[model samples]
Target: MAYVPVKGGEAAILNALDLVAEERRGDPADPELTLAQIRTQQARAVDRVMAEGSLYDPDLAALALKQAQGDATEAAFLLRAYRTTLEQFARARPLETDRMAIRRRISACYKDLPGGQVLGPSVDYSHRMLDFDLAGEGAPTAPRAEAPVAAQMPRVPDLVGNEGFMEPSEPPAGDPAPGDLTRDPLAFPAPRDIRLQNLARADEGFLLGLAYSTQRGFGSNHPYAGEIRMGEVPVEVVPEELGFAIEIGEVTLTESQMITSVKGASGENPKFTRGYGLAFGHCERKAMSMALVDRALRADEFAEEPRYPAQDAEFVLYHSDNVESSGFVQHLKLPHYVDFQAELRMLREMRAARRATEQEAAE
Candidate 1:
């Protein structure tokens, strides 16, 4: 993004910034909103910001949301900007979602699984109308369940794979470390790990739209939810001195495994292929959309022609990032006087020449 220096507008810029800050704070009569309130009350927004920002810090995400005046895309942009300043001490080991302390676990594919489908916390079955009572302070408190959710729940893919109905998700040869898009520029024909990472940090709305396109017959993959789980899993890291991993802390994650249509190569039995999605918090929509797009992007693997935007890995991966997309689109708001003038001059000259030619022909 190019930024042409203003000739002389320092005072105006400062005042503009100050006005924005004042507007963000709202009226002085109301109580100042705290970061904690945003974290607890608007947790879904924080989760979306964290997932899109590619950061898992709730407080920071909340702060970003507050600073951005609740604009989630802007909040995510602020989070990403802040993330660049922090120094990385270590890379944590991958989480085991199978051992996740189950919160809300459900499978669209199965009605009765190993551990009965647990709906920990959701508004899926709630009325769509807005509650005017909530407009006032001190709403009625929700009742709590006596028992805590189970420690571990069996995954749907594992159950289906055991029966040889689902395709095997074997680790890649040598189990090599996945490429980091943050560290390296994404190249064409990206591996599944990198593709998954791109989709994980992708914009929820964008992914959701693309996923919907597939369901509308833009693409041919009929997907089942298979499993959607949200929970906390322990984070572990190995220190050089210890040579062994130690539990650091746990971060809440939402995971989705989307089972797609069956496909088989010659001499192989047909089995259902799957797409994976993982997010920082209870973002079911984002996770589910990711799963659908992930499967669609794997057209080459399943020997399917790429006929849709979702199936085009290059198109999806490149545009999925909200920060980048927002930046590029918003950059047009910045100074473009010189460029616009140049175009204007060329247009005027072309019009003048055409008029002169018309006059000569008439004469």
Candidate 2:
């Protein structure tokens, strides 16, 4: 009689999954907390959700966490899911960058602009140290104001516009509508809207990894941050009833312009071209990284030698999502007993045939 050892494999797998679930539930240090706690305590998590998903309701994100039972990651997923359902009431009158209510702004070329650059809240060049007092086991108190505004502020003007370095953009003839990426599947050689939508929801770790690869001589381009800005931009809509545009709300945004030096070719001037990046909320690092990657993707425009992996549009864009990558990788744990059994049978037959052949040769 022949015996197949594949029996009870399904049961074993089920038991293992159950064990893992039990362990997750039994952990004491991170006991199940409500979304309110996460919102109040884990503010960085809320920031990450808003930045990655292009949604800005910290409270709602917290509520989602509560519903998801204190899983911050799952809470972010829920927030993104909810965000997709909301209707876009109006496309903002294409933001006049000149009119931005800047909180923190900087430019690399000059020490100041027509309006001086303001260094708002930033950790740049600061020592990274943990303040343990902030983690006291009680409700945290708000810090006292150190100083008050005493002087009139100047506005930060556009560098390119002021210098007339680039041609001015032509104003659209009509009220241009934004491209809907969700309703339509992305086609090859995607437009800016589709690209931005994909990038907004991209996994931070994956983006960071690709960015690191570029820095390490893979599709590398020398890049400098021309400007980085974080602030509120006005959103406006012209209702049919109202003849003129009305300010509806304001959204926080981070914008980065990266300047890359490229050699002149084909009778072109040897000047720096720009790579643009923008994201919801104050995500300076992500914005800067995005600008760098965007420039790297435009290898042909720079007249640089194209490297295989970085220059492959499909490979770079397709694998940039954490949710998709994680799900596919983890799916391997699902039952494949039949396939394994078939492989085992094939291996045994091949071994037996080889032994028989060897014996026959000896005879």
Candidate 3:
């Protein structure tokens, strides 16, 4: 069980790293992929990197994607780590979805809403068929109708709020500052704001699994998708010297509004409770899953006891981080000779003891 170091491990590790770099360089003559192409062409991918990273620089996200070899979670971690190095200039004002330049907006609760259903870029209704022509010289496409402006489109939540059909999602009482999960460590019995911030940047796969668990009778609530919208929302920052808020930039965002039934309280009519999700880029699936988990974590607020893993805040939030989970899982690949030797010694001792007992019994 004594320690025995591997000879030439340092040299082998350095050589292995070099081999990995060389392997990443596929055909030498192939055209290099530019950052612009990754930002525009691999837009959805870049969006995912930005969302999960909690940083919105497209160029950095594109670079992270290239460095990570298109692994979304790895790319996000790269960007997330880089963000800690940057200086905090100013915090942006809370986003206003009402002013969003909507590209895609749909409501499941109503067929006819203020702006009608705008089914933007979605393949939900498309047939699953592979095209042979795409492999050959690509074919040209015909021109289509000009896209409508997003400013004119009305939100489904706004319309419902007018008639008081759904409860209003007012800002947290007293306009309190929101928690920054990246800067501060997560603790047990987290606030709703912190829970949401953590979920917003949590791994998409982890959130998806937890959300699916909620639907399959683990912590099931009769849920309905009130609305899901994808569009560009302007970012505003108020500089202390400037004395007023100004638009700094615009970023694409996907917002989900989920409604679920809760038991009526104290002679009041049963009202639809809300679960919300917002993320960078066209991330409908992540957004929806986030909304479901957000609602599930609010069991105590709704006067419902936690009955499942999905509903347990401590369990879900701690294990849902991709970076932490990935690092822990991948770390097993490292040498564990010391630990293995101890196990081997224990096994040998057990076998020798068993043989001595057998010989005594036979005699």
In lDDT terms, which candidate is top?
Answer: 1
lDDT of candidates 1 onward, in order: 0.92, 0.66, 0.85
Clashing pairs in 3: none
Which candidate has the top score in TM-score? 1
Candidate 2: misplaced stretches above 4 Å?
A: 1-37, 65-73, 84-98, 137-178, 240-244
Which of candidates 2 and 3 is the stronger one according to TM-score? 3
User: Model 1 Cα RMSD, Å?
Assistant: 1.5
Q: Which lDDT value does model 2 have at 150?
A: 18
Q: Distance (Å) between predicted and true CA of 116, model 1?
A: 0.7
TM-score for every candidate vs. truth?
0.97, 0.76, 0.91
Ranking by TM-score: 1, 3, 2
Task: At residue 290, give the lDDT of candidate 2.
Answer: 73
C-alpha lDDT of residue 102 in model 3: 88
Predicted structure 2: lDDT: 0.66
Better of 1 and 3 by TM-score: 1
Using lDDT as the measure, name the better of candidate 1 and candidate 2.
Answer: 1
Model 1, span 1-363: residue lDDT tens: 335465466788899999999999999999999999999989999999999998999999999999999999999999989988998899999888887988889999989988888888899989999999889889569987645766777789989999999988988999998788877889987999999999999999999999999999999988999999998899999999999999999999999999999999899999999988999999999999999999998889889999999998889999999999999999887788889999999999999999999999999
lDDT of 2 by residue, 102-163 (tens): 77778876685654667777788688999787767777678765343313333222355446
Cα deviation of 120 in candidate 1 (Å)?
A: 1.0
